[model samples]
Target chain A: MTEPHDLPSAAELVEAVREFLAHDVLPAVDGRVQFHTRVAVNVLGMVGRELALGPAQAAAHGEGLAALGVSSEAELARIIRQGGADDRMDDIGRFVRATVRAKLEVANPKYLAE
Target chain B: MSDGGRDAEPAALLRSVLDAPIENLRRLSGGASRETWSFDCGGRPLILRRDPPGAPKEGMAVEARLLRAAGACGVPVPEVVAAESSFIVMERVEGETIPRKILRDDAFAAARPALAAQCGTVLAALHRIPVEDFADLPDTDQVAEWRDILDSLGQPHPAFELGLRWLGENRPPRSGTTVVHGDFRNGNLIVGPEGVRAVLDWELAHRGDPLEDLGWLCVKAWRFGVNDKPVGGFGDYDELVGAYEDAGGGHVDRDALMWWQAMGTLKWGIMCIVQGSLHVSGTVRSVELAAIGRRVCENEWDLLDLLPYGRD
Candidate 1:
């Protein structure tokens, strides 16, 4: 049961992870610790962002795409690969937003290392 | 790892300019098309940017040209000191990347408007540069660009296809063209006490519709989780637009900005997919790189929602 307020802000989580790695992880590592640090920090930051809004963002995107006659994640994924949407009469901005939103959902769980 | 082969040329060149001996060199993560490194030369700092192995010979030259163009335009960009086919030596700006810090900090929420406004102003200035100065640069046609990018990836995302078709049918006539910063956003800006110190990574610079830069800044992907606040999650949409207008960017229509924003997200999504494929196929490997590929879906979904046709 994660309450809204209980959830760490993306920045907070990222900072915590960054601090831990710098103080704890780096001192213990042997080869190319700096390289590992950069990778870890970057991934942490990205994960924090995803944790903040990935699910809601994805749902919003899926809804928008569905409105454009795209129903499933798989279908939307295909449309994204093709690089265009079906509807021309509609606003391009709105269509792009929805499409990106849906895609964000797919990446969210992946970011958490799930 | 030490610089092998021609990669050592930048350090050698830089050593000639600086008084100190080169101590250590390490590659910094971020650039996909080029190699970026931070090195110590006689206890002083320097950055080396070079084309990756197997990159075309012309790539470094193009980068130099774009950096020169950006400097002429009054953009806060790194000064290019020297360049060759293998590498370019430049002064590195000191600051945390805007995306790396600003997006996650609630303390910086108040500064969001200011940051976004600054971004707008910077973009407006970048766009004001004369296109003819970079005449040999190729123009990116929206439809053709999308098709080409998708074909290159070989991943059939229906959302992308739909987006391409929708954009083709609904493509707005180009309002005006200028020097476009193809990827202007939070991650690319180096923010310091003096405000945005430098706009780094000009590899994608080109001559195209000015809105391309605007759209890229406002793209949801760059929002870094603060999607509610437009302008790279720093401020409201109106504030950013107003800042650009104040900076002498003439006649910006909100509708036009929105259109560009969607396009920006779509383009980014495709790039992510392509990058992801590269990682998956073993062309490159790294958690961050693979993660970026996974992130493409978010951009695609964002683009889908921004367009009217996708509305319920």
Candidate 2:
């Protein structure tokens, strides 16, 4: 990979803020503010994960879409809606589950394990 | 505080409503669609639920009436003290409604063994109530309604589309309609040390298939990470479904429950989309609401997990 610019990459920057909120801000707050702080931490955590994983996941997604002959999610969704997936149920199911797993990988990976 | 000073103070309004000075009026948390406040009026503990400034304004009366009806039918519920067009005052039932506490804490250990069965019994009792009196609540043909909602959002979620298609193809021959508690789940119930003390949130109460409530409860999201105990993360399906049958909920169809569980999973994902859109649309921007949009994937994964070919 190319180190185009500075010290803190996008993922590192998000991790720093996420850690600050989790360690510094969370302990001091209570109730609604604390809850929102937790959510903010999770949001940043997701951002960090997306930054770190988005490129590889995007490539995998593009491959999966190509295998199914759909250029994009919207296109696949349209096909599924029009009964186009009936002929290729196994492939479509595999693609959809893989796509959802990729999403869960970033949004909340704990759900994937469950 | 975000009402921009246009609305009158909550305390002042409560003072006139109860004919006494309100005391210890503090806002409680966690209802995305409505405001929840805890307070005391003339030495009586109460909770105030009112619509926020620009949100919808007419569910309070409907909810209040449903509470009264449910309470009369032996379904535990908070006693509605008063009901106005935009707000409803009710006695504050003390117990834990948080799923994490109920799922993990030793405080509810004795309560866990019976929680799922209690949910069964409570739902059965509520479903027995006549629905003719409360006929105005929103009713939808679950699969098509949610599909339209996703369509209008204009974002394609193939996982959601698959779930919707499955639901439409395999709907249970419309089970007899009953007064279903639209959002009955672990999070909505006030659980005392002994058992469930009150069932809260009647906003989605409607005349629908009785199995809808049961299936919705079994949705994995409500489990709060306790996936093994499929009945709200506490008990197994045998205890729940058996209790419902034993308690006179009629012949239980196993396949139908699976259908509704998938339907419920799909509905929850779409609701997250709607909730997340509220933040993006600038209607009610908040970190909490925006964060919910990301949680939609959790529901999508669960929906796929429900598919027949799913790998364990």
Candidate 3:
């Protein structure tokens, strides 16, 4: 199942770019530029994590929505807002928590760890 | 050349209004909606907080008056010297407002033990400010207000919706109305070795339930990655409530505090979406705002943490 194209995958490429910014570009800049660059590196790291985890997370969310008899997250959200799912709040909470945790895994794993 | 001296308009405006020569006028960072210029007026350090021209005029004047009123009541706040139509000249109390340093830095170590209670005391004083003095300030139902804002964003967030639904279902009895610091948190307070030196950022001041401030302070977002300590990552809930009581603040209901804390978490989650929308809509186009968009999950997770129905 391996279709070899490049040595560095997309995630590795992003990691290398983030490393360049953190190691090479960050120290060379100062003030606002440096600050924004650091933020950019963080964003890139998040991107890398998302690339690695997004597909599985999306599948899990889709399955969760399907389990609640909603085809999409929007439908699930509408049901929650209208109190249509009030009787199943425990189920809804578990679904929402799992979905949000998946997001935190990419956005900030340290948060989930804590 | 620095962006500080790029425009002489500020210096010229100061000279015209204050009748004094200005020196060392520089712009301080971090005001999304307003301009903050720090300068010396006749050898005295002062801050010029001004809204952009053609913007609404009354907010700054109202803020200046509010700071004055809060300070007069023994609340730690910068003194307002003079306020024009769109700006305020105030005595600048120097201190650090960065949340991370205030929570973790060695310099603030001595201040940590007393910081949360002090925050409670200061908030108590702020809540005691006379409401009749500022008749223009409106008392808003925060649950309704945040729900409306999230609705206007036109994005469906199930977690936020769940939180709002819970808040609507568990409406707390109104305890009484007072002046509420709409954004009372670590980032807004200036801290030094002693404790809170000055409470900055009065733009969000309004008359509402004082518990809103307490709940907002306890929001996990303000904890700055330190989730264990509930009161701004520096002190516990009992310490805060005890100090508030000792400082003559009214008694707060525990359930009400929990409800407001969940509401505050949902409010911040919705705000992250709104902030990200600004970037997506190509209005402001800021990386910082774009990055904040990702923080929506943090608030969502925190809301689940605070919500009572499903917590095991």
Candidate 4:
């Protein structure tokens, strides 16, 4: 079964739109619209990053939870909330730090260094 | 105030209050629930703060009184020239309200170093204001309030639940009640080269433990990326506590303050979700609010950092 339509990938298309907003649309606007355009561009960049990194990041998170003996993130969270992780905060800390870093990779990578 | 038709113009109603003609009555920035207008009367700039038209005016009424009470207690606030049930007419204080500018601007270099201490002193004064007259203000448990708010969102925020549980287990012994400026932080404080010029947005004012205000100031979310300085990204926690004590504030319990910081981070994260829900639920579609929703992860990261863990 040969599938037909192939040109710019979804990520590539998003990148193109992001560049257009940043280079062309951004400098052309001012005040509220300009501000919102910047946000829009940021949102696009986030979408692109998510498209690129989301699957692996999700898998890594699941593995991290599994390593903590929790089957899912929700279970890990519930167990932690219930103080079941109180004795093993070291593990929880490492897991949370790694998890948050992965999220920052998509949300705003600049903040990771900060 | 005249009990005129609901459709009556605000300008006309204000004209009766001000003897001189009003000019340049334009709407300033406000949220969906509130209205802020700037106008000039008798060659003086004035601000009109009111609830959105047709909404109940009770909160504005309390805020007007709070401003006056705060001023009386030596806390810097906009002077309320005239107040009615519907709106408050205050002398517009000119200053920078943006936190980033106050934190990073070389123009505010002189004021930056002193801000944390200044905040302590001002907050002490605000807390000393007698709360007996604010009977209408509701007293609610801060932790329970946030838990309810988060639960109401119907979102499974495991980090929030974890944070909430931590707070519940480590609940601090209640400090003495005081008039608290609930939203006391960088953005709410109008900063100038001299120092904090005035406090703005008293809508969140209430009676609570004075330390709640101190803890809220240290919330990593409010630090605006300058997390190195725990006190609004400008000064240290000990420095904030020292200044507060010097200004007649009660004792500082470091553990309690840290607990509140963790709680405040979760509180802010939950607030971001709520703001995003307004966009998600089609109540108020806003890109800005939706973007804030993405920042909740930042709070989660901060929570893990702040919580007592293996580092201890």
- Which of the numbered candidates is closest to the native, going by highest DockQ? 3
Q: Which candidate order results from sorting by DockQ in descending order? A: 3, 2, 4, 1
B85-172 per-residue lDDT for model 3 (tens digits): 5778889898899999999999999998998899889988988899889878988888889989988988778888788888898989
TM-score of chain B of 4: 0.95
RMSD of each: 8.6, 3.4, 3.6, 2.4
lDDT of 1 by residue, B9-46 (tens): 65655675567677677778656567788887655566
Q: For each candidate, what is the lDDT? A: 0.70, 0.86, 0.85, 0.83
Q: What does candidate 4's lDDT look like per residue over B204-227, in tens digits?
A: 888778888898899987788897
Span of 10 residues, lowest total lDDT, candidate 4 chain A: A1-10
Worst 10 residues of 1 chain B by lDDT: B1-10
Query: In model 3, where do residues sit more than 4 Å from their true spots?
Result: A1-7, B1-8, B30-32, B309-312
What's the CA error at residue B306 for candidate 2, in Å?
A: 0.9
Candidate 4, residue B72: the lDDT equals 97
DockQ of each: 0.26, 0.66, 0.69, 0.54
By lDDT: ranked, best first: 2, 3, 4, 1
Candidate 2 Cα lDDT to native: 0.86
Best by lDDT, which number? 2
Best by TM-score: 3
Candidate 2 residue-wise lDDT, B144-232, digit = tens: 88899999998899999788778878889877788988899999999988989999888878888889999999998899888899989
